[model samples]
Target chain A: MIRLEGLTRRFNGRTAVDGLTFRVREGEIFGLLGPNGAGKTTTVRMLCCLIRPSEGRAFVGGYEVGREAMKIREIVGLLPESPGLYGELSAYRNLDFYARLYGVPKQRREENIERFLKMMDLWDRRNDPVGSFSKGMQQKIAIARSMVHDPKVLFLDEPTAALAPDSAKVVRDFILELKHEKRTIFICTHNLYEAERICDRVAIINTKLITLGSPSQLQREFGSGKTEVQIKNLGSRILHAVKKVKGVLKVEVSGNKLLIQSKDPETVNPRVVEAIVKNGGKILYVTRGAHGLEEAYLKLVGKNEV
Target chain B: MRFDRVWEIAKKDMASVRRHRYVLYGLVVMPLIFAIVVPMITILPFLSAEVAGDNLPPFAPPGFSVKQATILAMVSLLSLIFMFIPAFVPSVIASYTFVGEKINKQLEPLLATPTTDSELLLGKALGAFLPAVGVTFASFTGMVILVDLLTLPIFGYPVLPDLLSLVILFVYCPLIAILSVSVSVFISSKVNDVRAATQLSGVSVLPVLGFYFLFLGGLLKLDWVELALFAALLVLIDAGLFYLSKMTFQREEILTKWK
Candidate 1:
């Protein structure tokens, strides 16, 4: 439900978001992954119409970014990177304030506040001022505030950052429940494992969006033909002989060990095993060491590190 | 457009002010000093006249001999506008309403709402300016009452607010408040520090001080025509500054350059 085309935001002489383009489909959890200062938050700000883009346009729920910003605001809920909350007000008061802002009806305001507070499991502390809340509790209130109006699109910036694992799990489950309700979510985060688990498709954005696909698709696209073959016992001479096998590129040896690096594991793995068997070397475990999303992210950002 | 939301924001801000009892005390301290302390000091010489045996100089200004009571009332009223009122408005209203919220990061969600920029501006102005005008008006009334009671026996007349004084209270004070707050809001949006915004916005009072000095030195008088002209000038200044404020309110700059 969100589309960004060549969206760029520059401050002074520096580019914060540089020509970024991507689309988030309906009912999908789209992860915008980046390191710090990698334009993730800038991109989200453009999509939410919190700021005007310098070079391109973004659409949220069919509303143009700058032209229909008010319309976009009505239907898209945003949880900013910082928990932008009035600490002086109680949790209930904070939610009530936003519900009224979004034009939630008088009759439904209290009900909506109560429902989200309960959903966040913060009902007991609803009356206490948010200034007294823990960071996790405050974030929970922030989430409740964002959900009070139940907008069609939710732009969450680092929703689970700094939370205890239990609290993060609570937020994660709540996000998944939102997807079940068919709400589109755009999550900008550095937590790759969480993104890999929750996002339908992931986009690795270093200086720009280097790649966008499902986790496995990216793994296959960037992964080399490196394989791991463990043997119980093999000498240096035999390891060196296995390195000469077809498709085998490199080799290393520890005490009674052999590590083979190759470009074609299908040809090299069986060949190494046969050579080891013929040389009376015992085989233990054979596996391919395909690159994971974490490896992919490191590689992508690493190449662009200035 | 939803008054309820605006009401909620305003009420919430008031509640926050209440929680900071020091700030609440700060709001009233200047008024107390101008309205009560200064008037009492003016009456102290009269009350101790019998004990001191006519040792002190005349309490009224040298050339103006209207009455001691009249002098006391006018001094307190002028002091209220010149010093106490200006200091009170910036600290209690401008800082807390605009800069404080920006520093605390509370403005983000408020801006993220479907509320128009004008609505947000109006709501913040109402939240700060109404209370400022209310407190200043209450102090003016209290000062007049206290001066009347204190001087009724001495000067054979009750202290009264002259037409110029009323105009200052109703017209000039509100204009100054709007100017202070609008400048504070603009500065708050441009800066990340609340104290800087507050300090920067407080500079608007320097021109008021210039006028106070000129008036006190007998170089400028609060005659009907001069007062009306001054009122017109202040209103125009307020409007122009407000327009500049709205023009320079770059939302994109707030999102990016404020860092």
Candidate 2:
């Protein structure tokens, strides 16, 4: 639903975003990962038509960014880094004001406000001024405000940055619900665990696209393929037999556990288990190692830290 | 331009202003003091007592009776000085609306909407303009009534709804309000702090104050010709300031240049 080709933006003499190229498909949850000053917010602003790209072109919902900014604004919703709400106004008035700006009719505006506020669990406090709410509640209201018009694509910048763990879970589940409804979502976040849990695909960048793929795909490409095996009464005899198994590239012993590395764990795991069983070792369980997307992301963007 | 969008923004701004206690105090109190208290304290004493010709203020015109001339001079000077009320009141409201919103980061989402730049500017201008003008008119009405009631026994005729009152209330107040709003817009774009924008916007009323002193110092008279000329000059300045403000209110600059 969004496409960027060599998209770049410069402020004064500094380049905020440089030569970015990527595509997000319909109904896909695309996460944008970058360190500070990596141009994540700049990229989202370009697509939202809040700022024009300095060079190249981009299309959001089939309308060119600079040429048809109004059209793109009509079809897309953006939650900026800050909630940016009117603190003196009630939550209902805040959403209603935006609904009018988007040209939503009166009847539909009321309905959408009611629905989204309820969805965010803010119906009970809709009459309170937003400034009085906790940071997490305010974030939920902001998320609801972005979806009030039910746009085709949503761009959220740090949707859960200030939320507590429980509130973050609520927002995450709400995003998953949006995914189930087949809407395109673009998220810019520093929370890698949340990104890994919800985003169908993610892109790591440092003024340029460093990597883009599903979380597992990225982990596989940049991470070590290590598997951990827990066995009862594990000793050097079983370790030697498991080490001799075909497809086993390396093996190490740690307490009653075995660390095995293989080019293809799916192919090598069965042989290693069989060798352990035949050697009279009681097997407990075998599982893949930790998700290494965080390591891959840090390694790629960690250099030249600002 | 879509007027509904404009009205929506204006209405929202008005609602926000209503909830701001300090701005509301400025809106109501300043006009009351300028329109009611100053006139009553300064003009009512002149109507109650007899005055010698030598004791008359310099601006009092000679052809009429002492009572007539003194009442007319007092009403005219008070009405002209009241123009400063409209000019000063809008700067307070506009500063709160523009610079306060910027400080709170509330402009970003509003700028992201489908509305055009002109619509947003016009909406905010009207939001500040309406209340300032409304209070000015209300205070002018109160002053007219109070002046006429006090002077009717001495002059045997009501001395209000005169050319000065009509021109100041109908013409100069609205233009000065627009000028103040436009100036506040420009100042808000240049400065990041609300107090700084408000302090800078206080300069907008300097021209009005200059005219008030010129009349009070017996250098200028309150007549149709002088009023028309001043109104024309103010209209030109208001147009130029509005255009400059619109040019400065670029969405891209606001998004990028603000720290």
Candidate 3:
């Protein structure tokens, strides 16, 4: 688990992370979503004990950041923003080097290296120089290096950034598996969909805590409560009749999809669907608009999104 | 304090450095040129039979002949070249070790490791120091073999492994090496480029050159007493420099202040 009490980091007169307060529960996958220059990396670095907080305090695994940094570092692993693997070293050596630094015993170090490599689907390439690997492979090896020590907590900065869609899904599934293992994971990312899909609770931040809740909680609290209906043969008659439904507030047509803003879509979506069915439009599917979290995030972070 | 961590770091760095072509070149070529090649060519003409009984310099001690003094000058020059080895090799490696790692973004993960700042510094210093000391000793052995071969027919004996050369090789070489590693650590903090770090750390050899110049210019004799004094000065400087490097090597400083 990780806790920050008014954690602040300032460079010269400018604050990089200011008064950030949050707690990531054990076994929880916490996503830190922010735009560029939004202090996400800075926050992770401070929590990792790689950089000191300029003000206030932080603790990881019950050890204080400044006072017990070595202990805190011992319990936590970090996949930094860049996959800073030594190019000339083999993947096994890279993992072994970090495992030794983390004081993993020889037998366990070797075992963990092989295990993590296999888990990342890189076991066959373990003997090869990391430089010879592609970007996604290198990223996988870097993640394996962090996990080789089996730290109780992991702070991953953009874990899936370099991966293709399939590889990203693999990493996401691996993260979900880590949650099952009860390891606290802190992730910083700009990929809102990935955050929504994976993170148990997400925090949208910009130099300070902007919002914190589960993905659904955020969607409910900040979403426009709109429904997106995929209807076959959506003509003007059906659109007019759907609008004429009592709870329908507004309707916008794009292709065969109708983005319907209803009065509390949870209680109103069924009536709206029935209204469309009666108007001779066959409903293909009806779901909450996909951009709820995104809209909330844009509204929270404002136009300074980088 | 945790020596295993220190050794592991040093080993990893050495592994990384050996793959670099330029680093390997500097470690090998410069020492070979100074130790084997220059001694074979330059000292040959002087040690030849025709050059005997030449005029001695003003610095030559009482009852010393011109040829003996020339041999002594050859010894000093060879010793100077050997001293430069330890000083020069570390700058090349340390530049790549520190500044190179910073550029590669390797230092952040390294700093995030549980090892303390002193442990990290000692580890990197050892990485640069071991190869330098190895290269210096290896070159000295080569020069000794060549110099003894060249001068054997003239003096009826080998002339190397003398007290001054021994003192410099045993005492001053390691000291100069530590100083060089310390300078690189200090300069690596300020510079972002490996070349810049190497160029800036070239200053570590200034003390070696200063001693050589004073001895050559007849202002100093590198007898045991003077060698002791000079070595004492190096020890003090090495300590101060290690302290300065340690001050600059904090984890927070490395992660935040390093550019």
Candidate 4:
């Protein structure tokens, strides 16, 4: 549903968005993970045709970014990072105004407004001016506005930012529902867990895209495995004995505790325990090492070299 | 969205304008006082002097007589066109048109839709232009009737507003207003702050002031023939300004650089 090739945007002398290249499938939820100031907003703006790219090109719904932005706008719904709303207008009026701008037929406008507002739990406040709404409520209204016309694709820039946990959950679930409805969604956010929860595939864009894959794939790539084995009073003797076990790559002992590295834990764990017992070392506890996604993310982002 | 849709947006804008009672009062009531009340206060002495026949000072140097008094009065009232009509006010409105949306975080979604720049511009121009024009015209007529009725017996003439006055109000005021709205919208597109756009757009009235000074100095006459020509010239200029505004406006530039 979206294709970008070498897409870039520069402000003054600074490069806001570098040569970004990616593709989002028709019905997949794509996560754009990045740290703050990583040009996530700039990327989304270019896709929505709110701003032109400094170099390269982007296509949304088969419409070219610069040349056919108007056509693209017809099919794509955008929820900007900041909730842009007319404070004076009521929630209903805000949605109504946008629907008119989208040329949603007058006949269906009321129904659409009613549906979205109710979904956001903003039906009771529909007549109250948006200025009076709390920030979370305003965010929900913004979400509703973007969905008013029900476009084919949604470009949500930090959709869950500043929301209370419950409201944020609603937004997350709504995005999941959009995915089920077969709509392409491009989510730009700093919240990795949110992306992990809803995205089919995630791309981490640091200085550039450092990695792209499912969470499990990335965890497997960067996570390290080191088993911690404990012995009651092994001392240095047990470490030496376990080091002789087949498939045991390394072993270290501190007091009675042994930290071991094994390429195949299933194959070597039993042998290592048996060896420690045979050598007169009392075995206390042993647990399989686990790799975590946070470790993988930190490694991928260059927080740690190894 | 088409040009017709622009009118719908303008109507909604008007409704919003009405909702803000204080802003509405400021735009209309304040101008009415300056345009009608102040002029009457200043003109009271002249009317009294004309009645006393005490060294009947020239109403307006030489060529301005009581017969042309209404013309002079209306022309003087044209200052309200600048002072109150808010030719620069369009800057505030136009600035609010998108920048307000941006601050409120409403612009991105609006721009994300299929609404073309031209359509957006049209909607904005109407929203700003109609109110500015409406207030200006209403104030002018209100003052004219009040002054003519109040001074009819004292001046011994019906404040004979000529075809020239009609032409200036109908033809000239609108042209100047369009020019004002176009220039303000252009500035608004570039600036994110509503106040900054307003202050920058307020500069649009300088040219109108220059013309007023020229007319007062007798350097530029407002005779029927000359008035018609000026009206035509203003229309041409208004059209040029509209085109220039359209050319300079790029949604991308507004979304990015304005910040």
Candidate 5:
């Protein structure tokens, strides 16, 4: 488990992470969602004992950040923003070297290295230099390197940032597997979909904590009260008519679907449909809550692009 | 101080240094010149044209012919150059291992390991120190053999491993290596580029160069007491620089302040 009480970090008087207070339950997959430069990575670094907080305190596995950095470092594995793998060394050597640094016994180090490599489907290329691997493969090796010591808590900062969709899926599956193994995973990501799909509890942050809850809870509480309507043969006249409908707040057209925001959807939905029907529009599909997380995230983190 | 952790870090960095060809070539070329080329050029002349005590350079034996004194001074001067080996090797390797790792972003995970800052510093310093002192010892061994074989028929004994040579080898080289490693560690923290770190750390040998220039200019006479004093001064400088470097290598400084 990880806990932070009013943790703050500042560089040259400019705050990077500010007054963060939260706790991640043991074995839960927790996501710290933020835009770029939102202090997500900074928060993770403070928790991993890579950097100390300037104000307040934090603990990982009951070990304080600044006081017991060595102990926190011993129990927590960090996958930094970059993979940071040694290019010239073999994958096995890289993992073994970390395991040794963590003081894992030699026999067990060997077993963990082989196990993680095989799990990543990189066992056959274990002997080759990591420089020879592709970006995704290098990421896999980096993931394996972090797990070499069999740490109880893991801090992953953008682990799937630049990976291909399939490779990202593989990383997600591996994270889910770690959850099954009862490891606390704190992930920092700008990928709202990934966080929504995998995180048991998600915290949206932009320098300070904005909101924290399960994905559905956030969606339900802060979900955009927007209705999505797919109209066949939707014309400019029909769009203009819908915009003129009373109580209709905003209308955004994405291809054939009209995402409509309204003050009272129960009353306005009938009027908007009547306006569309009078304008000779054909309706195909009606849906909501499909992208509830994205709307909620954009609402919470603001309209600035992540 | 878990020595196993230190050794592991040292071994890893050394293995990384082994693969960097530029650093490897620098390590190789300098030692070869110090051992083979410099000895042949400095001592070969004394085979027939040396052994007089009257015009002896500093630190020569008390009783010796002109030819013998010149040879001893040459050997002793050559020993002075031996100190340059430790002072130079670390710059090349440390630039690659320390600053280069920082540039390549390989140090975060390294710093994230459970090892304490002191262990990390000692391990890295040893990583640079062992290769440097190894090269110095190996190169010095070659010089000793060549000097003995060249001087045997004239002096009728090995003129090598005399008191000055022993002092420089046992005392001076290790001290110089420590100073250089400390300089490299300090410079590695200050400079982001590997080339800049290497160039800046080369300034560590400026003291050795100053001593060499002073002796050549007849401004210094390194008597036994002077040698001890110089070694003492070097020890002080090494301590101060080491303390500064240790402060720079702390975890927060490394993570937030390095770049």
Candidate 6:
């Protein structure tokens, strides 16, 4: 639903986003992973037509950026890094104002405002000024505001940044619900765990696109190739037998578990399982040995910390 | 530009401005001073004066006694000061609507809407203009009633709804409002802080103040032709400032450079 070809942005000769090329398909949850100054916000702004791309081109829902910006804006919703709400206004008023700006009819505007506010579980406090709400509640209202018109694509920058863990879960589930409804969701976030949980595919970008793939695909490509096996009956013979399997590059045995490094875990894992079972080791569980997507993301982004 | 979107924006801004205490102070306090306090101070002296019949000042128009002419001259000159009310009030509202919203990061989502630049500008301008002009007119009404009531016993005629008051209320107030809103819009684009934008916009009323002073100091006369000329000059300046404000109010610059 969104396409970028060599999309670049520069401010006063300093490149914020450089040659970013990617596509987010319809009903796909695409996550943008980056650290500070990674041009994630800039890329989203370009897609939303809030700013023009300095070089290259982009299309959002078939509307060309800079040429059909109004069309793009009409079809897309944006939750900026900050909620940017009118603090003095009630939550209902805030959403209603945006619905009107989107040209929603009076009847539909009221319906959407009520529905979204209820979805956020903020219906009881709809009459209170948003400034008085907790940060998490305010973020919920912001998310609701973005979806008030029910646009085809949603661009959310740090959707759960300010929420507590429970509130963050609510937003995450709400996003997953949007995905179920077949809306294209493009998220820019530093929360890798949330990205891994919700995004169908993710792109790691610094100034340019460093890597793009599903979370597991990236873990395989960038993570150390190791398969972990937890066996109930600990045996040195099982370790020796697993090491002799073809494609098994290295093996390390710890208490009640084994870490086997291989070039291709898909083919080698079954062989290792067979080797362990044949050697009288009762295998309880077998899984990839890497530290999840976090390790792969850190390795690909070349950062030791978030 | 779609006017419904423009009106929506204006309506929302008005609602937002209503809750802002600082802007509310400007909306209520400035008009009160212009309508009630200033008139009470200016006309009370003439009401207490003993009759000084037929010793009229040279600048007074042909038919009036000295006391009558003094009251009319003071009221006429002071009516020009009412022009300053529209010029000043809009700055208060626009500062919050533009710079306050900008600082609060509210403009990003607003700019992301389907509305065009002209519609947004026109909406915000009207949002500031309407209240400013409304208050000015209300204050003008109050001033007319108060001045006439005070002058009625002495002169046996109402001193207001005169040509000067009509011209100032209908013509100059709206133009000055447009000028104030346009200048404030321009200032809001350049300044990120609401106080800074407001302070800078206060300078916009200087020309009106200059004319008021010139007339009060007897350096300028309140003639029909001269008033029309000044009104035309103000319209030209308002147009120029509005054009400049529209040019400065780019969505991209507001998003990028406003930091």
TM-score of each: 0.84, 0.94, 0.95, 0.83, 0.89, 0.94
Q: What is the lDDT of residue A60 in candidate 1?
A: 90
Pairs clashing in candidate 1? none
Best by TM-score: 3
Q: Write the per-residue lDDT of candidate 5 for residues B49-84, one digit (tens) a residue.
A: 745556666655457777777877788789899988
lDDT of model 5 at position A35: 85
Candidate 3 overall lDDT versus native: 0.88
Better of 4 and 5 by TM-score: 5
Residue lDDT tens for model 4, A87-161: 888999989988888889987888989988888898999999998999899999998888888889898999998
- CA shift at A100, candidate 5, in angstroms? 0.6
The TM-score measured for candidate 1 stands at: 0.84
**Model 1: per-residue Cα lDDT over A170-207, one tens digit each:** 99999999999999998998898788788999888865
Docking class of 4: medium
lDDT digits (tens) for residues A1-306 of candidate 6: 999999999999999999999899999999999889999999999899989999999999999999999999999999999999999999999999899999998898898898888888999999999999999999999999899998999999999999999999999999999999999999999998898899999999998899899987887788777778999997778878988999999988888889888877788889989888899999899977867678788887775332
Evaluated at residue B2, the lDDT of candidate 2 is 98
User: How far off is residue B161 in model 2, in Å?
Assistant: 1.6
Give the Å shift of residue B185 in candidate 1: 2.2
Q: Candidate 1 chain A: worst 10 consecutive residues by lDDT? A: A216-225
lDDT by residue (tens digit), candidate 3, A13-89? 99988899989999899999998999999999999888889999988999999899899989989999889999999
Docking class of 1: medium
* Top lDDT prediction, candidate number: 6
lDDT of 2 by residue, B60-165 (tens): 9778988778877888888887888888888988999999999888888888888888999999999999999999988888888888887788778887888888
The DockQ of predicted model 6 stands at 0.82
lDDT of 2 by residue, A235-288 (tens): 888999999988888887788889898777767889999999999999998977
Best candidate (score: DockQ): 2
